[model samples]
Target chain A: MLDPQIIIAGVLNGLLAGGIYVLVAVGLTLIYGVLHIINFAHGSLLMLAMYAVFFLWRLAGLDPYVSLPLVTAGAFAVGFVLYRLVIGRFSHGKDENILLITLGVSIVADNLALLFFGGDTQTIDVPYAGDIIQVGAAFLPLPKVISCGAALLICLVLGLFMTRTDTGKAIRAVARERQGARLVGIDVEHVFAVSYGIGIACLGAAACLLMPTFYVTPQSGYAFVLVAFTIVVLGGMGSFLGAAVGGFLIGITESLGGLFLGEQLGQIGISLIFILILLLKPTGLFGSRA
Target chain B: MRHLALAAALLAAVVYPLLVPNYLATVGMLMFFTAFIGQSWNISGGFAGQTSFGHAAFFGVGAYTSTILQVTYGWNPWLAWPAAMAMGGLVGAGIAVLSFRAGLRGSYFALITLAFAEVFRIAANSASITRGGLGMLIKADQRPINFQFKDQIWIYYLAFALCLVSLLIAWWLTRSRFGARLVAIRENEDAARALGIDVFTEKVKVLALSGAMCAAGGTFYAQKYLYIDPNIAFGIDKSVEMLLVTMVGGAGTIFGPLIGSIALTTINELTRAAASVFPALKNVQPLSLIVYGAMLVLIVARLPDGFASLLGRRRHA
Candidate 1:
């Protein structure tokens, strides 16, 4: 018999988890939309950003919250340079080439982190790391609530920027029809670099948000990236709004699964949902058929 | 001349373990095992153009099935191998049916396979039957019936035979109508479908074959290593390694995966040797992986057609 309080707590935790998933999924979707590359290295880039925030917190005594801008900027530069130097060369290549290249990048990034960070799990001790807020029978951790709020705000800002800003519109246009956007005088290459930068910036922001709640390791990005992939697929690939909705759904599913099915089965539950969705609704709940 | 070269190569492979030390033979066996995996992956990825990132699902299923049978039921190891292959084929068919029926293609299909593999890994980690993260270990018995031998050469020969069989299958594909259809699908699925080919059936068939072959490789791995763990059998690294070897050698070609396995294994062995020589390099635990990553980037950027094409170009010249 499940307690009402447990259900409520689970739902709240799921929402928080969903918020982070949304950020990561959106970053992946954005990269896919503009570059037509799945960017397997997306998670690895987030891992690097997480390390950056960790280092900043450890060395400068800076809060992860305070280090958000710096991490995001650094991630953007890394993504931008990665595109110009390596990914750009394969822009016109086959899909497998792009996949392999990104996979390779991920391998390099992870091993480099392993070399420096020594495979130990690292976590930040934020002031609110252990604080909690109570609502009736339910309690939410302060860090989760803050991260959830920040994720929403970032999503909203990204949405507005995509819709309202000229550069954002150009990015959307390129995503919608690359040849048309090119014909209309959009600097395809510049837009690509910027889009990649923005995609990576999203991961950077997510890393900072995540550092308070989750442990960081050289391999941590991989698991999160897998979850993000599931969310993206569930939300419908390449659809921004779908990613947001899908993230919460996966988050809730995971929490409920853990409560009902045990910890390992909870992870299995997410994968099952992912496979079922791919089988039954390849277009996703909100995405139009490709 | 080509036939003579092929015969010479086969002779060399058979004589290799006899001449080399135990360590070198072990490395050669591992290289051949990788070649088997890469070749199996090539059926779906190179020929059919269904680049899966989750071949580990099949590999794990095969590995776990055989190991579980041998360890728990006291079954002969040779008997478990066929059963493992069958289980691998079933899983492969199931994935192919579900994905192809849903019209999933390209990246969507790839991710779904990965999810399935992850699901299997997690399941293995949780299920008591798999003994969870503690893993399963086969008792050391130097009996041929148990698929265990005291001499490392037996395992090497077995691995070599498996690699040869996989290569033959690949070669047969290149000469068969089914192979042509697969190539057509790879070139353009829509066009192939428009040409009256049963694209779904073809994809499913190839995937099943690929899955079974990969599972066979897994069974071989279990028999040689005498251990089966979720991480070793179902990890993303296994999947990526299959892709890396196949792509580096040339995905669709018969010799591509074999060549890639040899090259990659050599690189890995060299790096490990270097690490032992240099105290500083020893701290970098996964230096070979970094090298592999770098090689993948370079190959994709410079030799998209793989190293096999280089040989083709030379012959033409």
Candidate 2:
């Protein structure tokens, strides 16, 4: 018998968490779908995006919400360049090689961030930082709601882009068969770059949106990445729809578990869920076994 | 000749700790423990190609089981060690059965292990008996039955013996039929299955064996230090250190984790010492991590078979 008010609060938090999970897992899945690499640096890119929002807000007095577009654009450019120069070389090899290369990229990014920023927590100064909205018996934070909304919008837009656009078709073609896509005269390289760029852009958008609510730090991405990995696995590796649903499920479970079992146990609950899902469904909920 | 090599290696291991200063002795002990754990990891990860990144689950399970039994039930520390090792094996088998049944192999297998470790860490952090993040600290005093010792040499010997046991187990497994099956499965699971190898059974067996060894390492670690914290017990860093060492030295080869562990541990000690001396260089600590990461990339890129293969090729040539 949970309190109705507490339940609503949990739902809100879960929704917000799910939004972030979707954002993180979508990027991971997108990269994996095209390149077949988990892209361990995906989390590092998110950290970079968080820093971008923080600096933009801190240095220029720009609201993180307003700077989201620029961050997305910047992430796209960096991701494009990274794929072209580094990831491209590792793309055509044993999968383990990609894992190692991405791991290297992640290590470099994390250490570089640590070197530059020092290993301390920094946050963007958001207006209405302490403000809350009372919904009937439940209080909801404005920042989380906004972030979730933005996340949903991004997911929708990305879904449309993937389904409707000519470039999106080419990307899907490559994902299905790289050799076949090449045979069809499609620029597989460009598709790889664009897919990676879009993936990073999603992370960039998430970072800017999240900056208002969470603290930005070098190691902050580790927990986020781990959680996102769980969600991605639950959703089925490379399934966009699965990532979205898995995100919400994880968020709800995390928030509800936090409320019932306490914060520390809540974290363990998520990890247990991952193990349980992995042990139960090898193909994942949405993953199609070809 | 084999016996002679063993005697020589044992002599070097025993005497080196005594020759080194106390600080260096401690570092050597740490390296020995790391090597043991890395060898344990190598059994399942390297030999079986499971890539389990969550040996910390077994490590923590061992530490907690023994620590709690010794402190609460007033069990003898020596008795608790076997209990811990057994518990580790059981848990390892459980994890193997669960994960393998679900088709979790390779990277997915690694992910599951990491998830389990995280779960264990969180559980330890929350459980009241384990002191719930305040951690467990044994009274630091010299008592033989208590398994507490003031002299670094005693702890050094104990860790050294544990390392020997671990290495022996790894070697024994390598020469066993189980080891052959594991190698076959690692090379190609489908082909192995076709060739009448019980792939799942071999994987689970290797995972359990590795888990037991790692757990024993954890138990000894807790006894020596007389302190057990959830963060250290179920740390991702500990798991990574094991993997990095094995990968660097050579996977799927006898004595690879031994070499990797010693080399990496020494490097870690140097990095930590350097970082402390040059407080201005806080980021210097990450230099080792960066190098380790780069090494992983290079090994995967150029030397997929690891350092052992390079040595073997040189010998053959």
Model 2 interface RMSD over true interface Cα atoms: 1.9
- Candidate 2 CAPRI assessment class: medium
Of the candidates shown, which would achieve the greatest DockQ relative to the real structure? 1
lDDT of 1 by residue, B203-290 (tens): 9999989999999988888888899899999999899899889888888888989989998998888877887898777754478778
- Tens digits of lDDT, candidate 1, A213-266: 899999987888788878887887789989999999999999999999888777
Q: Can you write out model 2's per-residue Cα lDDT over B1-317, one digit (the tens) per residue?
A: 65897799889888997788898898888888888888888888888887876889899889988999988888888899889999999999998998888776667777788888888899899998898898898666588777877787888888787778877777777899888888899888999999999888888888888888888988888988789999999987788778888888888787788788777777777778888998876677577777777777677666776777877787678
Give TM per candidate.
0.97, 0.94
Q: What is the lDDT of residue A26 in candidate 1?
A: 92
Q: Residue B34 of model 1: what lDDT?
A: 95
Q: Report how far residue A100 has shifted in candidate 1, in Å.
A: 2.6
Q: Kindly provide the TM-score of model 2 when superposed on the true structure, using C-alpha atoms.
A: 0.94
The number of clashing residue pairs in each candidate reads 0, 0
The residue pairs found clashing in candidate 2 are none
